[model samples]
Target chain A: MPKVGMEPIRRAALVQATIDEIGASGSLDVTVSQIAKRAGMSSALAHHYFGGKEQIFLAAMRHTLAVYAAEVRGALGMADSPRTRIEAIVRAGFGTTNFRREVVSAWLNFYVLAQTSGEAGRLLNVYQRRLHANLLYNLRPLVGDKAEEVAQRIGGLIDGIYLREALGTKTTNGSKATAMVLAALDLELGQGK
Target chain B: MPKVGMEPIRRAALVQATIDEIGASGSLDVTVSQIAKRAGMSSALAHHYFGGKEQIFLAAMRHTLAVYAAEVRGALGMADSPRTRIEAIVRAGFGTTNFRREVVSAWLNFYVLAQTSGEAGRLLNVYQRRLHANLLYNLRPLVGDKAEEVAQRIGGLIDGIYLREALGTKTTNGSKATAMVLAALDLELGQGK
Candidate 1:
């Protein structure tokens, strides 16, 4: 007896609103009312969709991860070689859509929340495992037996760049961040010109 | 008429308590009274010493940085080569004293706080600049023109390891973290066997 498509649109609105609210506040001290207001919806609707702040936050994190996954997939799809695949994955990390200030702030909070929340922790683990596996998959063809180590080192470098960029301490761009990763790659694979 | 030397001890206690509280709570939701209680003092005494929670957190951060700086000094003192110096610096990051659960939590929150805090941001910049400069200094003799890039890469790797270990997602030891940096080093300087 209720609207079907409206739920997805409403849910999506709440999720984006959660990101904006957390980003604007730069902390997880956001309220359901605040997010609801940002989404141009009633608090009751927001609550009905997400249940609580933690749930709302969880949903937002899932949305962020999904977008990131899609970007990585798109990048991988365009690649024909291991090197290009690696580059694509690295580039996706700092791509325009993934590197925005609000999203980075959301990521910072997500990292903090994962420290205490089991659900957040599990979500983080899944993302990290997937990233590591993907890197290892492509790296194995290029580095052979050292693929695991190379993947970890590369993954660490990417994370380090992301964390620094997210903190806004060292100014960097997508190309700059990607360049660093490639430098590490060249070092590992003897690919430097 | 207050006891001489009491202020330093009291202030140090509050800062340590702040770290402990943040570590225990895994977030910045800690109250001033909680920190004061952990420090075995009244909230009024803590306020007298630090002005408020922000100042208290700032002091805690300054204390953490000071301790890190001291470790770097000690490590650099025992260094015999550029490689050793780099090794010492990397080891210092994952050293038991600095890599404690609480200190890392404080660091994660500090990163989050820096996003919106000019003071926090500046402090982080100073710390990062010093670290980068130190790495570059040791790396120049070994890698020449590429030292700047290599230093940035190594610095990023160390940070990545610390950030990962801090999140408690993947358990890594000091030597392991240091070895990863060294692996990157070998890749950079072609020193890998």
Candidate 2:
């Protein structure tokens, strides 16, 4: 007696569960049974929805990216100046919804998966490209001819912070991470002034 | 008959083989048998020497750090200024011995392993602390009191670049990575002028 739209709901739950499981395990060695149990469903049901562990993890990553895209769009929409736009984009990286331990662990695993999986690699490239484009757009007004270089530098900083936090070498909340990036931004953009 | 002094040579070979296996696998999902086979030894011998994959990987990491330490020391010994010293350390990151495909892959795996393994975490922290200390020492003369902040940013950039190259998101050689970091240094130090 499942509803017509219940499948989507269940899939979303399973994806979230997969992220949680990976985070709890601190690795990508999660099992379908563990994810299914976390989602309050049977392994058979989870497999029915996502096929296997890789599919579930892929869906989780897609969900992560989609949320990130929306967050960036929302942040940019509210920004009024170049500085604010840049800050908005940078802040979006450490947004509460995306910076949880579970999500961060999932991100680390995603990068590792990207090394060997074509689909994961493509997703990562898209994410990087969009981030680069967004930063360049915001930076062009501030740095003139140096926008590309500045954007790449800032992009690397953001990724570096994320990578460090994701790997547990650094423990920082959103504000601290945001401050570090903004400091770099200040050095780069402030110098131009 | 085995020689009495063959242990060190065998251990070094096993460490190199471990790096090779991890690089070829593109993940730490490699087996002890695979590593042993790469070293042209039996799994039992590898186990006898290192106990397990974790111990073997730790020995490999220690070896990587030793090489990096020597490179930085050598580069520093011949340096003429703080700028050159900073450049030397940055260049050391991409040095031929440290930036090879095998070594870089091992580095990436080390970061992932750090998230779940305390030993790995300690090793990473030591590396970070030493790098930070080194950068701050070199930056203090150029930027005065702002050296610490600047050093952290530069360290993050170096790590970000390494992560990108290791993950195949970006492919850059030693000179290119050095130039990118020097550009950041120029921005920070140039602004002070």
Best by TM-score: 1
In model 2 chain A, which range of ten residues has the least summed lDDT?
A184-193
Best by DockQ: 1
lDDT of 1 by residue, B1-193 (tens): 5778799999999999998999888898899999999999899999998888889988888888889989988999999999899888888878888887778888988888777677877788888999999999999999898899999899888888777876787677777777888888887888663
A94-122, model 1: which lDDT tens digit per residue?
A: 89898877788888899899988899989
Compared with the true structure, the alpha-carbon lDDT of candidate 1 equals 0.87
Clashing pairs in 2: none
True interface contacts reproduced, per candidate: 0.59, 0.49
Model 1 misplaced stretches (Cα beyond 4 Å): A1-5, B1-5
Q: Write the per-residue lDDT of candidate 2 for residues A1-193, one digit (tens) a residue.
A: 7568779899999988988888777787788999999998899999898887788888988988899889998999999998999999998889998888778878878888887778988998899899999899888999888998888889988888787777665678888889888988988887432
Two-chain DockQ for each candidate model: 0.64, 0.56
**Candidate 2 chain B minimal-lDDT segment of 10 residues:** B184-193
Model 1 chain A lowest lDDT segment of ten: A165-174
